[model samples]
Structure formats: structure tokens, C-alpha cells
Target: MSDTLLKPHPLDEATYLRSLGPGRLAGRTSAAYWNMAGPFGGTTAAILLRAVMEHPDRRGRPVAQTVNFCAAVAEGEFEVLVRLVRDGRSTQHWLVELVQGDVVAATASTVTGPSRETWSHRPGAPPPMPPSQALAPLPTEGRNAWLGRYEFRFERGEPIPGRASAEAPAPALSRAWVRDAPPRPLDYVALAALADTFVVKILQVRGDIPPVATVSMTTYFLADEAEMARQGEDYLLCTADARAFKHGFNDQTAELWSAGGELLAVSNQVVWFKG
Candidate 1:
């Protein structure tokens, strides 16, 4: 069966992820969607963050969030519990856990704070990305169901999962322009998903796909709601690369930038993979 037959519009999926009450939320999986194993990690993180955002006591926007995948999340009727760990005048911290039948499938911690002018500097420059019109859309035929849900135009190091590289996996990187299919408005929620959407970079290092799981991940938002709204459905530039891989584990770092060159977010993750 094709994913198109089972997947609903992304916005509908996002709305359904909203919390039912204070620190309480629920969700079901789509039969049509699958990522190497269970549901997508990005969506799981977004749903956990949504729980905190829906909390009646929630304050400020999300400045940073860290999610730990304790175990695989089984689809259908999952519950998320969010707690206000700390509430301060300028910042709020929250803890969330997604439980499936008494098993703590995943947990997340978030820091939300008011926006203030501070000494700002971006020491790194954005990668030289080609105009959206200049690159061709990455084909999604015969791939994971989730790949069909986003638009990607790769500049280098495209996801050739399950295939061996010409030589060795020297340049473990993937740079592209990406956005949701049917184009959803950019938001912290959506941005959270984008952070983990790329295929595991370690696959590039090993020259083939192996058993892999993202053990932990953290994302830092540099822009607020206003910045997300300004971009509408436009595609954003993204670059992901692995720094080291050894002992069945690897660390990867990624950068996301607006088409206009504004640094949007930076993300890092640790994944367990078979050597």
C-alpha cells in the first residue's frame, strides 16, 4: 500500500497532537507512515513539546529542548505527561514523558524564555546553498513512507541509505533545502520536526544502513514566533554532518537556516548504531 492512502494532511496530524489538558496529551499512529522502525522521532519530540506548550501554566516561547528516547514508542493511544519543573520571571523549564502502557518510551526537557536583546553574534556562516529553483526535488520513489512527506533538494551527500558509497564514507554530510509537503506554516513545532528529519548521518560514515536509533537529541532555537511566521511555506536550507563514529555510537550536528540567510536553529544528536 502507498503512504498516500494512509497519511492525512500534516496540519491535521499536528492539531490532533495538541494536549487534552494540563500536562495531559494523547496520539495515535498513522498506518501509512513508518521510519526505519516505529513512528518518526521528530514528530514524537514535537508532540512532547506540544504538551508543555498546552500547559495552563506555560509561559514564554521555547528557547531549547532536549528529548531522550528511552525506548521504542508503540503506535496507538500514547499519553504524555508534562510538568513545570521551574517557573521564573524570564524563563520556564518543563519536563515531559511519553508513556505507552507503563513503559517510559521517551522523555523531554524544555526551556522557554521571553525574548530579549542580548549581545548576539553568529560565528559560523551558512553553507553555500543553491537557489531553490536551481536544484531538483529528491525523488521519493521506493523509500520510507516519511520521505514522501517532505520536499528535499539536495546539494551534496544525499541519503543513499542501504547502498555502498563509491569509495569510503569520507564526507559524512547532507546539505539540502527542505520543507513539509503541501507546505505547512513554519513554527517552533514544525521546526522541531525538521531538526530530526534527515536520515542518520552515521549511515554515511559506515557506507550503508545498519540498525540505528537516536538515543538523545537537543535543539536550540535562535528565532522566535515572529521569525517563523515571516517565512510562511518557503523552504529552508539545512546541513547535517557527523563528527565522530566509534564503538557502535556516533554524534551528529546540524544547522538550519532561513532562505534569506537567517540562522534559525542548531541541533545535535547521539545515535546508537551497529558497526
Candidate 2:
């Protein structure tokens, strides 16, 4: 128990938050958090969303966003360039790119739309799972540092080390309750990051934690500010499943739900994995 271990995570404060710059926004990298490769994809996504949210010309709220990982990000200062694609009466679109030392690490497209009321019907079924309090907390000992920032109460698919042996292979699905540890407010930026929080789908299905990286990720936001606030810091029900795995690549889909049975966001990604 030392003061060094008790300090807030670099990302917990202003790490991903960017400052306005000449032609592009500028931001610093987090020194305390890193995955097997580079900075966590969740923080990367949050920064991309922050670029759009802070843009002077940005209109409406976030509806959908897609981030493509082009290369590994360097651990230092980076620049984010955003361009307004289309500005409609009710909706707006944007394109963003994050660059570090002339290398484009990530690119994204975001769509925002004003809120309106109309007749609507949801055909989706409610989330079928036990309460968050009923689930057991997953152990995190030797995993990436970023995984330790969030609390996961897993209903299934814990990715225990020995469970992935050749004799007993876990299913390719994960159902869990997830949320930030210190209870941050729910917003598009936070939710966008959370959408990518699930463990890579390939590991759960293939029963081995191999090298994994998300090549591309697309997310659709379903809830508004009210619904997001209603959920608060309560654990969100989340599930991720691999749809296909072939040729060193896999496609996965994920969904996040509110405690009161509301769909918060849905995400799909194509990931590169090693056997």
C-alpha cells in the first residue's frame, strides 16, 4: 500500500482529453495504461469521440461511429484531425483521423442526429440474465493493465487460464456485467469506449489468449441522455460472440444493455488474431 499505487490513473483525468491546436487537436498518451500492443483501444475510441464532441461545428448527438485501426499508436503526443462531411438539418457526419509522427494510427467516421419523437417499435427481446449482484467477480492477475480499470461480474466466460486447455474448451461467448470502477458519468464518449471493452471474442471461442488486435470497429448508439443517466454507474449487461473465424481473422458482435432492459449500444468488429 503506497501512495504511488493510490494515485488516479492517467486516463482517469485528462489523458485522452484533447486541446485545440492549429489545424488539428492535440493530446497526450497515457503512461499508466497499456495493452499488449499499444494504448488500450477503449481510450483510443474515447479520444476519437472527444474530437467530434469538442469540434466547434459539431451538431447533434452521437448516433453511430466507426474507428479503423491502421497502425500501432506511439506513446507520446498525437494529433487528431476532423472534417465535417455532411451537415443536414437533423443529422451531421464527420471524418476523423489520429496521427502520431506522420503515421496514421486510427481513422473514424461519426454520425450525429438531433433528438425527435416519432412512432417507434422495438422487436428485440429483453436481456435474459441474472442480476449483476448475483454474478461472480472475474479474477484479473496477469492480464493487461487496462483490464484492471474496470470491474467485471461475469455471468459466464471468465477466460480462466487452465480452462482453455485442449481437454475443456470454453464456448465462444461471454456474458458479463461491466462498468468503470470509479463510477464515471455515462456519455457517448464513455459508452463508445465501453462498446469495445469486452475481451476479444476469439479467445473465448478458441479457448486461448492469443495475440489479438481490432482491425475495425463499428458502434451504434441506442439510448439518449436520459436513459444513460438512468443506468448511472450500475453494471451494464454485455455480451460478445464470434460470428466467424477464418484465415487469421475473426468477426465479432457485441451488445450492451441497461439494468432496466434497454439496449444501450451495439458493436461489431473484425479482429486479427494469432493461433
Evaluate model 2: give its lDDT: 0.81
Per-residue lDDT tens digits for candidate 2, residues 1-275, read: 99967876445553455567633888877754577878889888888888888888887789999999999988788889888889999889999999988799999999998767888788876568888788877766677877876789988877665566545556778889998765666778878888988887656665676887999999999998889989987888888887677898988889998878899899999999887
Please provide TM-scores, in order, for all candidate models, with all chains considered together.
0.91, 0.91
Q: Mind giving the per-residue lDDT tens digits that candidate 1 earns over 1-275?
A: 79986776674574355557766778776544567788788888888877777777887889999999999977687888889988899999999998889899999999999888788887878888779879999899888777777899999877766554536565878899999887777888888888998888866655677788999999998887777887778998999988888888889899999887888899999999875
- Which lDDT value does model 2 have at 275? 73
The clash count for each model shown is 0, 1
The collision pairs in model 1 are: none
What local lDDT does model 1 show for residue 216?
A: 98
